[model samples]
Structure formats: structure tokens, C-alpha cells
Target: MKVIQSFIVLVFGLTVLVTNAQNKIKIEYKPEHPLKEKIEGQSSLNFDFIIENQSKDSLKLTRLEVSLFDKQNKLIQQKFLDNNGTAPSINTIPNIQWNSVSTNLLFNPFPDVNSMTDKLEYTFTFNDSIEIKKVVIPGDYEQATDFILPLKNKILVYDGHDFYSHHRRFDYEFTPIKQLGFTGNFMRYAYDFVVLNPEGKRYLNNGKNDTDWFGFGTDVLAVADGEITAIEMNQKDDKTFDIPSLKDKPLALYGNYIVIKHGENIYSMYGHLKNQSAAGLKVGDKVKKGQKIALIGASGSSFFPHLHFEVRNSINHQAEGLPSYFKNYNLILGSAKKEGTTHTITTGDIIQSK
Candidate 1:
């Protein structure tokens, strides 16, 4: 995580007063860890920058440009920040306050290197008046590791059915955890599987009782064979609309969850289970794939009964989310029915276990 920063004062006009005004605007950048090294193709890097205005008048930012260089100092690519169709224009900045902006840059065809030890340069234009350039941000890039699907022969309820699923709907990008911080897995690629009846409804009859939910008390099976690394079984199931706040109990975010280490730096997490359903299991216990581990429930921070499933790189939620494919599942996308192994399911797709 080595970082190199530089402060440059660029003066385009001959007027001393204008030079002093340009100096009042300061720009600082913070690059994510992997960007410091060489990044692999199809991977993305994030950049965080702090823009400050020190002058008496407001500062308006109009455009930004980023340049990437190879190890030989050759210009690889140049990119302009695009905010939809129009160039990104920052609101007038009040004096003496810092404004933070971040960008996620994707490298399509990354340079051929084991590790990137090059530099990324940035140029910012303020109100079309002057250009501020900063160079020599140190970082490298590496190839991204591809993850395999860990689950087999398990039915993710909404796979072949449709109902109101929340952040865990796989393709639903507006997840609460993704909004928390810049780093960590934070349920970004997690999926929530809620039971739905044949009528495409989540509950039956009046829905007064928890049993009225279609998938309530259904067996939550192990996605892959692995030793149990962590388990939390004491949390109580919440009544509809009575889900507890995570502020009161932090771990309640994944009430009665289980973590299974499937491989080195790879783990599977099953969250929001029925109370005491996993009481028989202990850490270090070996479980087989498709084995029943717990029952789906509306525990922790859930609004209804569902299974929260995710493939993460680490045992904790702070790790990066890994993409996974399922083995032997039937995917029904409207009128089409595709059945096979290595199936990737997204939001609103009806999936059934083969």
C-alpha cells in the first residue's frame, strides 16, 4: 500500500493575481491498494480525491483527465471522466471546505505484466480558467483471480419464482452494504432467496403467521463441502416489520449465520436462519455439499423469511465478494428454459434445482 503524492502549482496566465488564485485550489488523490500494483484485465480500480477551495470566491470544476502509463513510461491510454452525456460539473465549492469525489476505473485490456510498478497522472480543469496537473502516483497491477461456483443441487427459492426480494436479489445494485464504505465485501454480491408459491406470491392466505410464508422453515443446504469456520445461532427470528436495528447489535446484520471455508481465501456464508436450527453444528465440523445446515428464517436485519447466501473471499463481511455459478440448475427466463451446470442467476429469474 505504498503511496507517492506531489503538490504542483501551475500558472497559465502572466497576471500575479490570477496565479495566486489558481494556487488556492488544491487537489489530492488516494488510490486503492491493488491499483498501486499491476491490475489484471477485466478488473476495476478505485480512486478517491479531495478537492479543496482556499480562495474567497467559489471554485467550479469542469472536467478531469486521467492518463495511464506502462512500466517503460509509455502512454498506454487516456480517459476523460464522463458523467452521462455531459461533462461532470461540480457545484460551486464554498471557501475553506473539502469536497470528495471517487471514480472506479476499469481496465479492459490490461498491460501484459505480472505486477504494475508504473504511474497514473491526472489533470483537472477549473472553470475553464486553468489546468492543474499532478504526476507520479505510485502503484502496480496484478491479474485478478477467477472464482468458481461453490453451490450444487440447491434451490434458491426465487430462482424459478418471483416475489419481492430485497438487496440480496443478486442483480439489485442498490444494496445497503455497498453504500457503507469504499472497501470490503459488505454484501455487494450477496443474494437473498425468499420462498414464493406457484402463484408468484410470497405468502399464502392472510399471511398472519410466519408459516404462511412459502419458504419458511425450509432446509438451507450447504453450497459446498467444507469445514464450518464460524456460526452464530442465538439470534431470535424477527416478526414482520419488527426487524432489529443493526446499531443495537452489530452481528445482528446476519442473524444466526454460518461461515464455511471452501478453499484458500474462499468462503460461503449463509445468513438469517431459524433460531437454534444450527445448534448441532460446531466450528471445525466438516459438512458435505447439499447437506441441510439450517432452516430459512426472518432473523437479524431481515424484513421477511429468506436465506442470505454469498460467496466471499474472507470469512468476514469485510472481504471482497466473489462471483459464483451453480451446478445443475434449471433457469427459466420467461418462455425459455435452460437447464445445465454452471448456471448464473440474476434478479427476477426463475431457477429450480435439477
Candidate 2:
């Protein structure tokens, strides 16, 4: 395995100061390195957009337009928004508050991925004046680290990083968690895995007990060779599928999880494990690529037994997510199975290590 040097970049919109006293606008985006993902066989780019009001005054965005350009500055994609026609219009950003939107760009003749760029233009009316601002968003793809399946069985990717997956759609705008030094969609490319029975369902009869799920208690392995930097094995596993209140408890989202540092600022997190499963493990412990580190369980915010896995830039929860590519795996969907080497896996994939 190759060690990826720390190169995570955070992109923010240009701050434009208005005539109003202490009024400014801020824009933020995730998956800082926008990679071209193959959606439905067409090359696509997905992103999350956020607009923040950094002052004590309200800001009403009257018009908004987003455009994508290639290396040659040729327009490849564009999005338009207005106060009317667009459903659920909420262009007004309250003082010190923020608004977010998620968009995807699909192109038949995909632009050169190396130098593609995005531009955001907005018209705002504030302090009795109409101001127009345009910010050029520039970024490139981040190098993906080669990883292996964390679980040792033919598993189902119940929910992986897709356009609509909670992992990709979650916007960490909560002030409490942000104030606690935790922010960012660290699980942007995360995976939730479960094992299916012969009937193509997640569990067997009744499905009430964690024991009924095939994935429960299964050993979770290290995705790569690294030193364990953090461990949380005390959080009790949920007995049922009811979602727990994770308010103000940032760490609870990953109950009984483990963090392993693979390289400079490169870490892999395995979350929602059975309590005490990693009882003998502690920080600073060295683990191999296939070493068993914990057991899959319904813990924290999880509604059922599953393994939540992700590769991130930092060991902490406030870091940016890094894309993951697996080696020697078979992605099976229905009767069609595709063998992959160094390939990106998506939702609904029945994966088996080759």
C-alpha cells in the first residue's frame, strides 16, 4: 500500500463586504477535491454548497447562478435559481445563520477532470441596495488511497456514498457540535455494510434482536496498516433499532469506534461497534491491514446492526473526508457481477473480496 501525503484542501467562497455595517457573505463547499463519479454510467460531479451570513443583519439572495467551466473556459454545466418558481424558496439568511444546497453536474462529454472549475454568482438585496457578487471556485481531484474491505465476508453496501445517501447529504450546520470543535461531513464517502440472508433481506426472522442480523458481532478489520490513535469501546450498543438522541454528544455518532492513522493526516475510522469488542485494544497500538479491531453492532445513532467505515484526512471528527478505492473486489447487483481492481464502490453493491 502507498502512503498518501497530507494534501486535503478546504475551499471557501470569497467574503464580500457590503455597505451595511459589519455585513458580509461566506460560502463553503465539501469534498474539496471534486472527483468525477460515474452516475448511471454518465460522468457526474456532486457537491454541497453553503451560504452564510456573518453579520447581525439579514441577507436576502434574490438571484443565484452556478456555472462550471473546463480548462479552456468552456461552459460545461450551469444552474439557475430565483425567488419565484423554485419550490420552498428560502433565500433569506437570518443574521449569523446559513443556508445549504446540494447539486450534481452530469455531462455526456465530460470535461477535462484535471482543470474543471465552478463559479457561483449571486444577487443580494440588503440595506436598501442590490449587490451582485461572483466567486470563481477552483479545485482538482484528490488522490484516492488504496484500501481493502474492512469486513471479511461477502457483504452488502446497504448505504454508501451516493448522491442521496445520508452520508453525502448531511450538512453539519448545528452550532452546538460546531462550537464543540466538530464540523464538516467527515463521512462524505463513508460506507454502511450489512450481510443479507438467502431471501435477499438484511436479517432473519422477526429482525428485532441484534442477534438476528447476519452482520452483528462480525469482526471488523483494519482497512490498512496503521497505528491505532483513538478507541471508544465503552458506549453501550443499542438493544433495538430506535435512533438515540445524539444531541450535543458528537462522539456518540460513532459509538464504540476506532481510529487508525495510516499516514500524514490520513486516517481510517470504523464506527458503531459492539461494546467491549475492542476491550484489549488501546491507543498507540499497531494494527495490520487485516487485523480484527472490533465487532459490528447497532450502536449510537444506528438503527440496526451494520458497520460504518470511512477514510478521512484527520483522526478527529472535524476533518475532511478522503475518497477510498478498493483492490480485488466483486461488485454484484442482481445477476450481474463486475470484478474490480482499484475501483470505486457505490450504494446497493453486494461486495465480495476477490
Q: State which candidate has the highest TM-score.
A: 2
TM-score quality measure for candidate 1: 0.59
TM-score of each: 0.59, 0.73
How far in Å is the alpha carbon of 162 misplaced in model 2?
Answer: 2.7
Clashes of each: 17, 0
Candidate 1 regions exceeding 4 Å error are 1-183, 206-208, 239-250, 340-343
Query: Residue 212 CA error for candidate 1 (Å)?
Result: 2.3
lDDT of 1 by residue, 1-354 (tens): 122222222232335655776687766543223343111232233233445567666544565666877779888777654223443322211121224322221121122222343666777676565578867455433223322222322334443111222332222112353343223423434677776555557788887677888778888888778899889888788732222344333335787888888888777888888889985999999988888888888777676777888766675424555545565666655556677444335555556666
| lDDT by residue (tens digit), candidate 2, 242-350 | 2233434444577778999999878898988999999599999999888899899877778889999887787555677766777777876677777764645788888
Model 2 stretches astray by more than 4 angstroms: 1-24, 28-48, 54-62, 83-138, 142-144, 239-250
Best of the candidates, lDDT: 2
